[model samples]
Target: MSGRILIVDDDPVQRRLLEEAVTRFGYSSRVVENGVEALQVLRAPEGGDIDLVILDLVMPELDGYAVLEKMRGDGNSTPVIVQTAQAGIDTVVGAMRAGAQDFVVKPIGPERLEVSIRNVLKVSALEDEIVRFRKSAAGTLTFSDIITRSPSMERVIRLGERAASSHIPILIEGESGVGKELIARAIQGQSDRAAKPFVTVNCGAIPENLVESILFGHEKGAFTGAVDKHVGKFQEAHGGTLFLDEVGELPLDVQVKLLRALQEGEIDPVGARRPQKIDFRLISATNRRLMDLVKEGRFREDLYYRLNVFPIWIPPLRDRLEDIPELTRHFLARFAAEEHKSKVSTVAPETVALLQSYDWPGNIRQLENAVFRAVVLCDDTCLRPDDFPQVQANCASRGAGGGQGGEPRIDAPLIAGEPAIRPDDAAGERSGEHAGAAALWKAQGSFAGFTDGSVPFGFLRALDRNGHVQTLECVERDMIVTAIDHYGGRMAEVARRLGIGRSTLYRKLKDYGLEASNGQDAAE
Candidate 1:
C-alpha cells in the first residue's frame, strides 16, 4: 500500500495513467520507457527501494518475460505484475512461468490493479516471514536475521560473529526487550552447533528453591516432588548451547554451583553419586550489571569474572533511531499476515516520524506489539499516526512536561465507545470519550502476552474477576471465540490465520459448543 512502484511501458499515455493511478492509491511510482531502463534501475544499488514492477509484456526489445528471466538470474526476487493488451491464457502462463507474481491485461481498471498490488505485496511479506521462521527453527539463524541499518548494531554484530567463531563464554548486556536472546540464538546458530538444540532458561523466572535442581538435574526421590528423574537444562543442552537469560538473577547458592560447573566442565545432580561432564557452550545475558551486583555482594565475584570473559553490550533502541523504519515495516508485515489484515500494508511517513521521536524504553518488543495492535485496529490500507494513540499521547504529554521513563499515558480512549480514566484521576472518574486512554505500563503480570501492556478492550484476560489465574482451556476457548467474532466467522480464513487445521478448528468449535453460531461454515 505504501511502496515505490516501477512502471515499465513504451506508451507515454499508458505510463502516465499508471503513474497517476499508483500515486492516487498511496504509492510512489517510477516510470521507465522500456525494459532496458527498467533493468538498469533495478540493478542499481538504489533499486532496492523498488518494491514491485509493473512491466509491459509486449515491449520493443526486452519483453516482460525476458526481463523476468534476467531479474531471476541475477537473484532478484522483487515481485512483478506483467501487463499486456493480449488477454490470452498462453500469455498469462508464459509470464507466470518466467517469474511474474501476477498478470494483468492492459487498460486495467483501477480497482483490479490495486487489488493485484496488495495481494502481491502481502504474499511477499508472508513468504519472507516463513523463510525467517524456518531458519530460526532449524537453528540456521545468523546475524543476517537481525534487522538493523545502524552502525552501532553493526559493531555489535561484528563482536557477535567473533564470539561465534570460538567456544568462548559470552555475556550479552542489554536492556530488557533489546533482543538479548535473539543475539544469543544467532551466536549459537553461527557456531559449529548450528543444527543442535539451543536451550534457553530464564534465570529470573525460576523459583529460588528449584534453581539448583533445574540447572543441575535431579534423580528420582531427590526431593518431595521429585517422583521422576529429570534432566536439567545444562544436560538438555548437552552438545549445543545453554543460554542463561537474566543470568544476574541466579541465586548466590546457584552461582557457586554454576561457577564450579563452568570451571570443572561437570555438574553433580541432586542425589547423584558422581559428577556428569557437560560438553555444551555457554552464552549468558543480563539486563543488570553483574559487576554492580558483585560489588553489592549479591553476585559471586569469581563467577562474574568467569561469565564476563567476552562481554558484548547491545545499545538500546533509542540510541539507534535509524533502525525504527525498517523494524516497523518488518513487524507490520508479520502481524498483518497473522491477523489476516491484508489491507494493512505500510506505515505512514508521519507514523514513522512519531515512532522515531519517542524513545522505545521497551525496545524492539514494544515496537512489535504496537504494530500488532495497529494492524488489528486499522480499517484502511495503511497505518497512520492516529493508529498509535498511546505513542501520540506520550509525545503530546512530553511536550507539556509530563510522563517520562517509557510509561504510556493515553489522553483518550484508543477506540470509540470505551470507558477510560487517567491514572491520577479519582476512582469514580470513568467517563465517555473525553476520559483518558488506557494508561498501561511495562509489567510482567497479567499482560505477559504483550510487552507494553495487556490487550486493549479486554480482548483477552489472564485472570478472572476473582483474581485467580484462568484455566488454559478457558483462555484458549475465549481466544478462539474472540478470533471468530473478530474475523466474522470466516472459518477457513480463521483457521489458516490461527495456524490450525480445519479439522482441529472444528473439534475445538464442537468442544466449546459454538458450532451452531456458524452452522453453514461448520457443515463445510
Candidate 2:
C-alpha cells in the first residue's frame, strides 16, 4: 500500500535523511525546512492526502508542537509521529496530550520508525472508516424512553444523548438494578449507529474458562469443544456497539486481551493465524469501583484509564425516589397487562407512600419485581397496602428502628428458630462485597413466612384499615380470598402467592368459610 509522508525539520541534513527513509519505505514524501512551511503545505486542500507526518520538535518559525496543536485544534486528526532527540517520559506524554499519535527519539531506528508509522496509520484508517460508515441521521429511540420526573434522570438522558453522537467508549457506573444496561441501550439507540448491532455480554455470568473464546472467538478444533468456527464479540459488533456489563468481574487475563483489542482496534481469535480489524464503539458497566480493583492490583491500571474515557454514573433508586411514582405506574401498566391482571392498573396513594418509605436496597429492579408481585397479588382495580405486605413491613421496621440483613422487617423479629431465607439466598446470589451491595431481583414469597406459623409481614394491619384498624385474621383471611380471586380459584397459584401449601390453602378456605366462594364447596 503506497501513501504520502510529510517530513518537517529545520536541519537540511535531517530533513533529507527523513525524506529518504520515508521514500525507501515505499511512500511518496514531502520535505520542508521548518514547521511553518510544513503547516502551509499541510493546510492546502491537497494536504488531506498526507497519510503520516514525521515532525521534529525544535524547528524554527513554529515548532512541531505548535503545528500539532493547531492541526488538532482545527479538528485535523491526521496521524503524526513526533521525532525528538529527547524522548523523556514527559515529552512523550505531552506530545500525546497535544494529539500526536506517537513519538520517536533522535537518530531513529528504521524498524522502530516504520512500526510506529504503521500502527498510527492503521488506527487512523480504522477511524476514517468509522467516520465514513457513520450514519447521517440519529435514530428515533433517543433518550425519550428513560421515564423520569426527577432532574437527575433528565440530566442523565441529556448527557446520554450527547454521548450517542460520537464513537467514544463509555463507562457506566451504578449499583445493581439501577438500569446501567438500559442507559447503555438508550445511548446506542439514540446514536447514528443505532441500526447496527448492540451486542451485550455479562462478564460475571460467563465461566472463567470460556471468557477468552467468548470475547475473541475460536477457530474450529482450537479447543476440546471447538467443533465449529465461531466469531467473537468484537468481530460480531463490527460497525456497531459492544456492551460489557459487570465488567469488573473480567479475569485479569481476559482484561489484558480486552485492553489490546480496544487499543489496537483488532482481535486475534483463538488459533487464528492473524488478527482481524474491527470497528465498534464500546460501553462498559460495573457496579463496583474499578479504580479500587486497580489499586488492589486485580485490574490493569492502563486498561482502567482506557475504559474510563467517558464516565456516566447512574444514581441508585434510593437517591431518586421522586421518580418512583412514574416508574411504578409504568411498570404497573406494563406488568398488569403482561401478567393478565388488567384490572390492577393504578397504584393507590398509600401504597406509593409505603414504597417511598423503605430504603429500596435492591434498587429499581427490586422495585420492579415488587410491583410485578403486587400486580399478581392484586384482584382489585387499584393496588392497596394488602397487595404489598413486605413493603409495609419494611416501612414499619424502618420506622421503628433499622435492622440487620434484608427485608420482611416489621414491629418484631421472627422467632429465634424459624426457617427463613435471606432475600439474596432465595435468588441464589451471594452478597457482593466487592460489588458495592449489588442486589438482584428477589421473587416475592421466595423467602416464605416463618416456620412457626406466621403470615408474611404480619404487621400490615397496624398501618392499613377500612376506616379502622383491622385484626390480623381479617388481613390474613382477606389475602387468601384475593389470591383465590386473582388466580381464578387455582389452589396452586393461590398457595404459592400466600406462601402456604395447597392443603394449607384448603384449610384456610374452610377456616375462612370461603370454600364455596372460590369453587371448592364440592371438595369441602
Candidate 3:
C-alpha cells in the first residue's frame, strides 16, 4: 500500500489528478511526461523502486503502448494501467494488448480511477507473496516439479506468492502445457486460505450455456439438468482459493458476471431471489492471448482489466535448461517413491546432460510423464538409456551422434552409421600438435571408431549415458513420427497410439515439421 506509483502522461493536469488519487490512497507518486522519460526513470539504478505505472496511451515522445511493450520486452513485470482522453473500442483493445494491466478512458472519474489503482496495487502485493513462497520452497520442489530456474520464473514465483497473500483477482499467462495450473496451486498452497478448499474450474471444458451455472451455484430447478442444488466453484471455494483455468475461454457474458463477482465479492445463485456473499481468492490462468482476443472484439476490455489485476507469466522450458538436472532428479525420485520401487532412484549423469540439451515444449508435465514411463518399464535396478527408447531414438535421429550438453559434439562417432574420424584418435596421434582441438573433442565426445569403418561403441555409450535427458518435445515428436510410420501414416491410429486428440496430433505434426503436405510446414 505504501508503494511508489509512476504517472506517465503528456498532460500535466491528468498527471496531477492521478498523483492526487494515489496520494489519497497513502501511496507515493511520480509523474513522467512521456514514455521516454518513464523509461529513463525505469532504467535508473533505483528505477525498479517504482511499484506500479499509470500510463497514458497517447503522448508526444512515446505512446503508452510503446512504453508497455518496452517494459515487458525488457522483462519488467511492474503492474501497468493505461489512461487515455480518447475512449474507443480500438483504444481499449490496443492498450490491453500492449500488456497494460487495465485501461481507463479519459475524463477519469475519481471513483473509477481509485478503484483501478487499488485493484492493481492489491494484485501486485499478491505477486510479491508468490515470489517469497517460491524462493522458500526452491530446494523442496524438484526442477521437474516446478520446471524453471530462470530469472523470469523466479519473478513469477515471487508474484504468485504476492497474489496468494492478497484477496485480489489474478491472471496468469503462458503457452499451452506451460504449467499455469501448477503455478495456481502453488499460489493457493502459500496463501492464508490454504487450510480451506482449493477448487478449480476449467472454463474451456464447460459448455457455453452451462458456464454460468457452473460458476454461480444453481438451484434445483435452475436448468433442465439441475436435478438438485449444486454448488459452483466460487461457493465451494468459499474462505479459500478458486482457480479458473483457461479463463480466456469464457464467453463475453460470463466474463461480465465474473467481473461483477470480483467487484462485489458476491454471487446470485440461479433461480434465487437474493445474492449470496462469498469470501474467496480468485486465481485464473490462460494460454490464449487475451489481449489479442479483446482486440478482435471477442473479449470485453473491462473484464480483461478486472481479471488481470495481477499478471504472472511462466516461461517455456527451452529458455531455462539450467533447471533440468534438478527437475529430472525430482521426478525420478517422485515416481520411484510412488511406485514403491528403489531400483529407479537415480539417473545417469550423461542422461541428465542429454535432457539438458533438448527443448521442453511440454515443460514439467512432460518430464514427469517420461520419468514415470521409464520407471514403469525398467527391468533392472539401474534405469539406463534403453529404458527410454523413444528419447534415445529421437536424439539419434537428430544426428547428434552424442555429447553431454544440449548440442552434439564433433568428436562423437555415428553409431548407427559407418564409422567416422574421432577427435580423440587424432588428438592421441598428434599429441604435440592440435592439443586444444583434441581436448575440446575429448570433453565433448571420444572420436575413436570413425576412422575404422566400424561405428564406435562410444556413440551407443553416449546414448546410453545421456538418454534420460532428452526433452519432452523431442521425445513426443519422435514418438509421434514413429507411430505415424508404424501405422502407415494413419492419422486416427497415430492419435490413438499417442493417447492424444486427432486435432492435437495434427498440431504436433505441424509443430515438429511432420505436416509438410498440409501447408503447416515448420520453418527452415
TM-score of 2: 0.53
List pairs with backbone clashes in candidate 2: none
Per-residue lDDT of model 1, residues 1-524, tens digit only: 44679999999999999999998777779999998999999999768778799999998999888899999999999999999999999989999999999999978999999889877876876777788788788887899777777889989999999999999999999877798988988998899999898999988667668889999999999989999999999999999999999787788888988998899999999988899999889999987778877887878999999999999999999899978877887788898878888778877777888999887767888888888888988998888988888777667766776543223345565334433423321111112421122332223224445455554432345565566777989877766765564345666545544545355677798888877754634432
Q: Give the winner by lDDT: 1 or 2.
A: 1
Lowest lDDT sum, 10 consecutive residues, model 2, at 434-443
Over 4 Å off in model 2, which ranges? 1-140, 404-524
C-alpha lDDT (0 to 100) for residue 370 of candidate 2: 86
Candidate 3 lDDT over residue span 363-466, tens digit each: 66666677788889887654567776655654564445553222234453454453443322110011123222333234335443334333322232223234
In model 2, what lDDT does residue 258 have?
Answer: 91
Give the lowest summed-lDDT range of ten residues in model 1: 425-434
**Can you give the lDDT of residue 316 in candidate 1?**
91
Clashing pairs in 1: none
- In order, the Cα lDDT scores of the candidates are 0.79, 0.71, 0.67
Candidate 3 to truth, TM? 0.50
Compare candidates 1 and 2 on TM-score and give the better one: 1
Report the lDDT of model 2 for residue 176: 73
lDDT tens digits, residue span 64-150, model 2: 889999888877777899999996899999999888888889898887876676556545544543442343123234465565656
